[model samples]
Target chain A: MICVENISKSFNGRAVLRDVSLEMQEGETLAIIGRSGSGKSVLMKHAIGLLQPDKGRVLVDGIDIGRISYRELRTVRRQFGVLFQGGALFDSMSAFDNVAFPIRTFTDSTEQQVRDRVLRCLDLVNLSDVGTKRPSELSGGMIKRVALARAVALEPRYILYDEPTSGLDPHTSTTINNLIKGLADQLDVTSGER
Target chain B: MAALEQRLIRPLYSLGRYALLLSKGFTSLGHFSVYRKNLIVQCGRVGIDSIPIVALAAAFSGAVTTVQTAYQLVSPFIPPSVIGAVVVPSLILELGAIVTGFILAGRVGARIAAELGTMRVTEQIDALEAMGLNSIGYLIVPRIMAGIIMFPVLYVTAVLVGVGGGLAAAVATDVVSTGEFIRGARENYLVFGPMFGLIKSFVFGFVITSISCYMGYYTEGGAEGVGRSTTQAAVISCVYILLSDLVLALVLL
Candidate 1:
């Protein structure tokens, strides 16, 4: 569970989020609907401790995240999977390596295990054939799908999608939406926050 | 009043942020293998790739110095050997060092700033942070390490090439006999001459690379911002090089 209490955030003294409050419980498929520049992403970013609110507290489970040490914050962050509006995939890395990055960072998984998991995640996202491609080589839709494959590579407890369906054609968007739903059911994800 | 405060306080804020980033780069080393790989890559970028430009600039500058020194200082009263003595020390202590510093301040500094600024604007840095990675340890430290390690080496190479050019110029112009020039070069050579150049360049490398990294790492806006940061990195690095040159000269000379 995550709780945002009276959160307020501003940039250059201009408030973006004002007195916002919300709670998200486990196993919930939450959708944040707002027009562009309506602070939807900003609010979602604060919920995961990515962007701290200037006033008010974010409680991940029961712990006030801002008060904790960086080590603790990082540990808390491991539970989250975020697909930024832009693919935010490492342009320098191949698709396979990007998906394998989190596993390499956090787990003592063997090379074979890492490869198997990466391939499986790519298969899940239907980007299995383009594992060797760099982000630049992939189309915009391909990049987003590859980024989504990377986000779920770790089997994160909560997945945050920022505009996952924003730029895709109807077919591609539907495909992505179905994958999001299928992955939640198959992985038994505790929370699918969009 | 606001503009005045901003002018004064902005630097302080930037200084605080720079120091914070430096501290993170020093302390939060994520993995040794990752750091080693990044360091090697950055070393190639800063050192191996910069040789041609540094050599070319220093060579011409050294040649001009030799010609000018011979023209001005040559008389029956002063020995031709004095040209060698003056040129060698000048190249080792200031000419070669400052020339190499300037090259790196523009080239490596802009490259670092542009690369990092692009990463920041493209959300790569944020992605690293979101993935529970120490972005500073991953990005800034390797570039900083490369700068500190390579600057002195490039300086040495620059000084040697420059002095060689000076010697060639002297020989061509009949400014000084080969024997007289060599004798004077050996005669006035102090242990501190090369040391001063090496030390100054070593610090210069850090200043150029780190300032550029800081500027890029915190960059905002977008493509235009990357362009602005790149220009700022080159300009600021050059200014800092001149300032450091003055301080090093006052202390060492």
Candidate 2:
């Protein structure tokens, strides 16, 4: 479970989030809908400990995020899968390797096991053919799907999506929405979307 | 008072930030297994890719030094072999490493800054952190490792090519025969000369890579910020290289 309690944040002394509170429980899909610049992403970042709140605190699985050391925070973060607004794919790597990155970094799986898992992830995202392509070669929607494949490679317990469907066409948007919903249902994981 | 603060306080603040980044990079070490492939890739990028330009700069510097030395020592009593003696020591002790450093300050340093700055702007670094990876250890360590390992390799290349270029120039100019030039260099050769040069190259490599990584890692804004960081990395690396060169010369020589 992720708990954000009365968190306030300011940038350059200008208030962005003021006394915000939210809770995402196990196997729940909670979407924070707001207009642009409404601090939805900021609140999400605080929940993940990517940004520290000016006031109040965030708790992940009962451990205070702000109080924990970076090492501990990393341990907590491993349980999360975050898809950024821009996909944030490593441009140098092909889509397959990008998805395989976390798996290789954190696991001691053999080459065959890694290849199988990467293919399965790509298949989940409907990007099986584009695995060999670099991010620059992939379209916006494709990049997001590849990034989603990467995010979910570790089977994270909590998945966060920041503008996941933004910049996508209507058909692609529906596909992404269905994919997120399906994944949440299939994985039985809590999801927070901004 | 504002100007004074900008001059003194701002630099101190920047220095503090640099030191902090370096400390964090060192402390949050990643597993060797994770970074091994990257280290090899970075070694190829930083060392092997730079050979052509380093060789070109080193060759010209050596050839010019040989010709100039021969021209300056025009005394009838002084043999032409003096040109080789002067050229060899100059190339070994100072010119080879310094020239290679300045070249890499622009080449490797700016490239690292630009690449990392792009990653920063594009949120790749943040993505790495969000993935529970130490972004510093993953990204910066291999580049710095490559720099320290490769810069000395480039230095050796520079000295060898520089000496060969000097010999070629000497033969072409008829300033000294090949035999006399080799004899002159052999007579003046001290083991400390190459040692000092290697030490200088190693330090230059660290300065260039670390400063570039720092500038790139903390980059802000967007495209403009990346451009600014790349320029700053090159400029700062060059400045540090020259400063360290002076210090090394004073202390070692």
Candidate 3:
């Protein structure tokens, strides 16, 4: 569960978010609809521990994110998987490695285990055959799917999506929406989507 | 008064931020194998890829130094061996380190800045952070390690090829016989010359790479911002190298 209380943010004295408040219970889906530059991304960043709000506190599972120890913050970070506005894939790595990165970084899994899990995630996102390609080689939509695959690679407890459908076609977008719904049902995870 | 405050305070703020960045970059480091793997790759890129150009520049400097020295010392009172004497000390004590430092400030520094700046604009750095990784440690440390390790090696190469170029020029111009050149090189030679050169190059390596990485890590905007950062990295690295060169010479020599 995540709770955002009276969040306010400003940049150089102009307000972006003013006293916004929200909550998400376990396994719930919260969709935030706002116009462009409406602090949607900033609010999302705060939720995922990426940014801090100027005048409020964000509590993830009842613990204040701002007050956590570094080790605890890292542990909290592992619970999240985020799909950035752009794909944000590592340009140097192949699609397979990008999806496999979390598994490799946090897990002591074997090579076969890593490979199997990476392939499974890729298959889930309909990108099984594109694992060998680098991010530069993939089309924009393919890049988004690869990023989505990477987001869910660790089977994280909470997933966040920011404009995940912008660069994708309607068919692909529907497919992704379906994937998100299915994954939520299967994994029993909470999600925040914009 | 407002403009003065803006100009003055901004740099002070930036300086504080830069120092904080350097400190953050050096701490809470983990993931050894990843760092080691990245270090090896950076070593090849920063060191090996830079040799040909460094050698070429050194050779030109050496050849010209020899020719000019030979031309000026045409009097009977001056021995031909003095050409080697002048060239060897010049290459080791100053020329090799200075030339290699300047070249790499343009080559390696600009490349690092541009690469990191691109990563910044593309949100790759944020992505790395999102994945529970220390992006600075993962990206900057290995490059810094690679730079300090490789610069001295490149400088030594420059000195060797530079001396060879001088020897070759001597043979071509009939300025000094091989035996005379060797004798002159052996005259008044102290281990301190190479020692000083190595020390200067070492510090140069540390400054050029770290400064470049710092500039790139903080880069904003888009492609045009990347170009600006690249130019800034090159120019700043060169300035730091030249300044440090003077400091190193005064302290060491």
| Candidate No. with top TM-score | 2
DockQ of the two-chain complex in candidate 3: 0.66
Q: Better model by DockQ, 1 or 2?
A: 2
lDDT of 3 at B191: 83
Task: Give me the runs in candidate 1 sitting further than 4 Å from their true place.
Answer: A191-194
Please, what are the lDDT tens digits per residue for candidate 1 over residues B102-156?
A: 8998899999999999999888887777777788888999999999999988898
lDDT-superior candidate, 1 or 3: 3
- Per residue, candidate 2 scores C-alpha lDDT tens digits across B93-125 of 999999999999999999999999999999899
How do the residues A1-194 of candidate 1 rate in per-residue lDDT, one tens digit apiece?
A: 88889999999999999998888788677888877888988887786677888999999889999898776787888888888888899987999999998898889899999999999999999989999999999988889889989988899888888888887899989998998888888887755445
TM-score computed on alpha carbons, candidate 3:
0.96
**Candidate 2: which stretches are off by over 4 Å?**
B1-7
lDDT of 3 by residue, B165-237 (tens): 9999999999899889879999957789999999998899999999999889989889999999999999999
Candidate 1 reaches a DockQ of: 0.60
Question: Under CAPRI classification, how is model 2 graded?
Answer: high
Which scores better on DockQ, 2 or 3?
2
Provide the global lDDT of candidate 3 against the true structure. Answer: 0.89
